[model samples]
Target: MRFPRSSGLLLHPTALPSPWGVGDLGPSAYQFVDFLAAAGQSLWQILPLGPTGYGDSPYQCFSAFAGNPGLISLDHLIQRGLLSYDEVVEASRRYDLNADQVHYGEVLAFKLPLLRHCYERLREGGAPDMAVAFTQFCRDQRAWLDDYALFMTLKEAHDGRSWHDWEAELRTRDPKALAEARTQYAEAFTLQQFFQFLFFQQWLPLKAYANEHQIRIIGDAPIFVAYDSADVWANPELFFLDAEGKPTVVAGVPPDYFSATGQLWGNPLYNWQRMAEDGYAWWIKRLRAAFTQMDILRLDHFRGFAAYWEVPAGEETAINGRWVKGPGAALFKRLEEEFGALPIIAEDLGLITPDVIALRDQFDLPGMKVLQFAFGGGSSNVYLPHHHVPNCVIYSGTHDNNTTVGWFEDLTEEEREVIRGYLGRSGSDIAWDFLRLAMMSVADMAVVPLQDVLRLDARARINTPGRLGGNWGWRFRDDVLNAGLAHGLHFFTEMYGRLPPQPEPDEPAEDATTEDELIYDPVDLATTA
Candidate 1:
């Protein structure tokens, strides 16, 4: 199903300014909703909200179904009497408030123990209602929560080592060892679950505020699971892993712009045959969990659904990979049978093939078109605005690209000429130029990275794909979100008819609807699904 013609910002919560070092589901989040409403944006897009593991990449999460406890608001915990203001003030002293990037290590060091302290308070029976709420949450989410909680508890006991690094019995998930670990680490398991509870409790209210302000969230979901994640650790059979819990094959893309050798993502490739045997149960659960926290979902690495690049384990690069067939239409058919409707956007970028396009169009799910990729060729280029169809989400750039300014500087003379000729303008305010083009396009959804709006350079780029460690750390100051910027965005939104209609004060938010808007309906197109 096509979304309303709307525009939004691609600012992950981590990019928001906060005294706590990293942005979170806190008061600053509510203020961001105010900013979006004031800017005439109807959507707020964010990266995956799962618990980050190595390199603090949201895409490489510890658990697909778990919320990032680090994003839980300490201030909210204080308000709930689970924590004290003194603790928050004390922890704030340890953070680098003036730094323009997130220091994930420092933030985690300060926040995790604090969350544990709050968990201790809750266990002490300081709040009866909260205890009941926690119990109910665990009960409702037991299907995934039980394994995730235990996985985290084990990770901590092993001094933050990967699941494969655990004792042989635990690595193999021997039944007796599992039972013993559960009995011994029961307290740790409770604390881990408690942290998840805090994350969801804070996040729901923030989502409600955004919904009330007419801004729907567009959260992300990666196509593959991390090898060190709870998902692969708990259900090894679902992934292509060896007996010792190592990936026999991994996930990545073939040669692309990011690297000559291609990016060896090292994520465990799915055993689609096994998934199909279970009716795609894990995929369904993961999607259902994502829906609880978002209105629309962006399916990352969407080409993988049609045909995935499978790299042999321990490969130096993704160059030595083979294209494997994914579940294709059959998997999506199963999802539709269970969920009724799917509001999804396909990230159909990088080394796309006709088969990928066929799969994307089959569901009528909106695909993405990044304007940065448009200058690579001519008018026949799919990313160009003129070629964009209404069933797509256009972007000036995404998290993986250099900022518009940086991209323009790095372009070859030939590529530069192409952009100037297509745009019919020189490089003055190139970021805004691209933004205007995207907003005015026929695509049903238009999203601009916050960096583009601020006209920041490459230094603010979020991720570089093949590179490691230095990505996903950029943050914007509170002052950058001034009224003038809002006016500029609002002006274009109004000009392009992307400004959402205001709902009456008494009406319920469109996002709060019970049933999700499915991507495919009974459109008896002679060719498509």
Candidate 2:
């Protein structure tokens, strides 16, 4: 799955500014697409769009296949007559303007009730068109949607307790218990399903707009399922879960730079042998569903495909974990059989072994290169831009790392000296320097974080590794997207020959800017820079 030569910005929709407290698939999202086009970017990469749980991390979702109802646009609802303009105006008035972060608690309290109101109106009005569309969506996605709707409804009913803590019959998914739940909570289930329909309805139009502008969307897919998620509960046979629906062995990383005890993620480990027995049907379906929403997918924790760490379920840390061989080549072989060439970007980060690289190359997948990891050593370091191969994506830093400015500010004297010596600078404008390095790198694609572009620091960091609280809540102010920033990016892109070519002087701009007619520069950054 070869990609055209291009560049993009990494910004989850949650970070987009909106008056409704949290960003949604609304007019602001389309405005973001327009911003990308104006800045000459051809990609818009985002984190998973799933409903977050516990720590509010998108990676740890309630359902891998369901959309986050939190992201459904209230403004869109008003246009559709499901909600009134006054309802939206009142809801917007309730948000705290001074909070620089997303108040998820306040947002959930305010938004959910309004969504329920909209759902009730739809039901009372006998909206056959909406009902038919929702029924058809469910029928087309029954393989996963039915289970997800039921899981969400039950989770709400149980006061948001983990599925493992539900009653023994429901915990083990007894057939009788499931049937009774469906009957008793039918309305709740329908509401959850309707929310997903609305999310997709808004999202598809935004995706089409991006496509029309010659921008491709890259979406993230975590390798493991949350222990308490619908994926684990509905298919207990696919994970290392006990008969009582509790995990026996869990997922985590071995001791690495980020943690001395290693990170115990606590997600249920997959039953690879079982998955292989069925021709990896579950994985195929997961990847297929992801493809429907994104043009290319980034497989998080790609090393897990080669081998994974197995930690006992009750362990407080990952110190006692052991390495177990994953399904590896056989699984990818089957994926290729089902999906043809895989349009995947392997998140080949953290304690990567030769085997992981081997498996990644076997599939012709592009791995990632982070410039922050480069200056710690000499030019031979794999992260150095000069050492990168064409089959890679380069970043200034990832979501888990501090914004480049923050990272630079926190560097020790010795590390700072080393960086100064490497780049022959005294570390002024560290963020922009790194951003320029990334844009000039030889990797096939380069993605700059929105935080780095804004020259923000740790205060605006997206995620901090090993830190549990006060993460994933950062949001940018609307005024941050001013013309100066856009023009600066446009200048840099055009200067480096990374921007799509301008039209002929006599040509009409609209006709010249047809979707298929956009010109993407094909200079291989790996070879040129």
> Against the unseen true structure, what C-alpha lDDT does each candidate score?
0.85, 0.83
Error of 2 at 172 (Å): 1.9
Taking the candidates one at a time, how many backbone clashes does each contain?
3, 2
Residue 255's lDDT in candidate 1: 86
Per-residue lDDT over 101-216 for candidate 2, one digit per residue giving the tens place of the 0 to 100 score: 77777777778888898889878874566666666666666778789999999999999999888888888888999999999999999888778777776776678789878789
Question: In model 1, how large is the Cα lDDT of residue 438?
Answer: 95
Local error of candidate 1 at residue 244 (angstroms): 1.9
Q: In model 1, where do residues sit more than 4 Å from their true spots?
A: 95-98, 256-258, 412-417, 504-529
Task: In angstroms, give how far residue 264 of model 1 lies from its true place.
Answer: 1.4
